[model samples]
Target: MAAQQPSEKILVVDAQADSAKLIVLQLQEAGFAAVWARDGEAAIGMLDGDDYSLALLDIRLPKANGIEVLSHIRESGKDTAAIMMTAHGNENLAVECMKAGCVDYLSKPFAMDDMLQRVMRAMTNRRVLLQKQRLEQEKDDFVSMLSHDMKNPLTAVIGSIDIIREGRLGTVNQEQAEYLHAAIDSCNEVIAMIDNLLDIHRFEAGRMQMKIAAYSAVEILRGGTRRFTRIAEHDGIRLRERLSHETPRIAVDKNAFSRVIANLLANSVKFTPEGGEIVVSCRCLKGAEVPWTRLPSYVTVPDGFAEKDCFVQVSIRDTGSGIPPDDLGRIFERYVQSRSGVGRERGGAGLGLAFCKMAVESCGGIIWVESEAGLGSIFVILLPCYLNGTECTGK
Candidate 1:
């Protein structure tokens, strides 16, 4: 079999047959795989059916307007770079096209050189963006996997401290108990941080692997709730766990997966004031979709995937002094502690949600949150079922 050569694919749309044909010749002459569409509707149909590296759009088309096509492209969540062509009087329309997410604009009656330049620029930008995304993804995956591996040791260390506290090793004096308590507290803090790092790293990496076994979601929820009972009581906060159904034995990694749920729960408890309420719940996610609209050009999602397949969704909601709207996107970023002066005072490194993201992603899932400052916050995680090994298409 002959090796298939990789080729740059460009889509050309123009109502004017001559202009479109000219551009197509240039692209083909330059060794690109080009598809020509006569109008906006045809362009959109082609885009929906095939992957194109760049789209050359004429602002005026017969069936659908260029701006309308651009809007549809933005809405469909495929970020194909669009270069709009406008006649002289349509400069303002070109600006409008740019606002509609056109990568570059070309005035009509332009030289072929100018057209080639713009197309080349758009293609170059797309490649650069894709490369940057891959690099960041790789870094996140490495860190997340490392964090998961480190957890066993952290768990053992914490477990040993508990044994000593119970006098399993030997009896100790009051002064020793106090010192041990302080040491254990410090260790717990570090462990929490490590957990956060692991979660964030995995989430950012976008490589979630699940080790599915039959287990009750309700049991996991209750276990997580019970684990935090003492702290909730101490803090005077009301914590509730609700199960919409007797959750079936679903496939999951109890320890790694529960940690994500626990992290959200812990954050709620930490951020919520005394007398505030924290609710942890498990329910089916119906009609849930990601805002892939803003994704830049050059990203491609594989088949057998839907935004929903990202995970079995879990949500942790809290009635704490909530996060500001502006900070919602950045909150999951490492060290972006929204609490800032207050959060620092409360002692947070801002890795909790980031970690949640990583852990969820490692299990082939996603994590996101909804919150308004002074209102409250709801952190949601989605993990895929059937905890199989990662399928590495490697883009």
Candidate 2:
């Protein structure tokens, strides 16, 4: 640990010259690269100038004060850790600093050895946090690239299969048509899985790019159902659409939006038994009409969505074995596995919903679910309606 400390630079912010110098020297001697700042303001400047592993801050300072400085770090969302030190050490103030995201707190005139241990702990914490973030980023990148690469060839194969099925190459018999349909279905299932993984990774990493364009909500919904029609029928299930007479255009990434629709429909088709019915419906929703209270926390609706005037709401209601009541709240979370029929037994426990939630939120939309144990489920989405690249206000 001592040998590794040289890589971690620490900031010591104390008004008292003697105390600050002593602390900096101790850290330097212990193999860390320590810098001294005479006040909170100077600490802030140092923070901005270079990457610091941790900050040893004094609660009382000439400018800005320790709490204010820490607040700045947090508000800036920098990857820096802080440990508050104060001459007037009170239990309440320590608790307050801790709550303010300090790694540790120390009183003036404290033992030098004790302070070093605290510094080491804070450094360790920072190291762990940074390592975790790096691992998560790597995982996300791996999945994103994997899925993107797999999708292209799979798509080409599907297109070629479609051409053959349509007799573009030659005449096709009924049996051959059945075989081609099976092949298409298998390829589509793979595609949907790949899309789910890719989108979920991109969304989680905040790297998802959307090419927002307006399209008829009804048409988008209908197009989503086309691929699933044969699969549902083959499973003895009915797949249909229920679009309103007055459907509005929705601004979204057409491909991602269609993928969202496909994900929900696929889920419905997977669990819904033979003879079950799946209805894809589209309607308009006022911003105030969204049941915000019932919308689960797992759905990541972006800021200001609640204030939109008009939205295009699409709901995929299925007569499948409904989600377990306890799982509804977490169904949209990544990797969530419900205990009921929607559990890991059938695969894709929580990934599809995560992708759906993120996709909707990317368009400044909201997505949620409603269901009981045996009453089937309805996955509802509300994407803000836009006219010419701007959100539509209710007329």
Give the winner by TM-score: 2
* Candidate 2 pairs with clashing backbones: none
Question: In model 2, where is the ten-residue run with the lowest total lDDT?
Answer: 341-350
Q: Tell me the tens digit of each residue's lDDT in model 2 across 129-170.
A: 999999988887778676667888899999999999999999
TM-scores for every candidate against the unseen true structure: 0.49, 0.71
lDDT of 2: 0.84
| lDDT score at residue 268, model 2, on the 0-100 scale | 91
lDDT of 1 by residue, 35-138 (tens): 79998889989989987888888888888988888888889888688899989999988987787799899998999988987788888898898899899878
Counted clashes in each candidate structure: 17, 0
lDDT score of model 1? Answer: 0.72
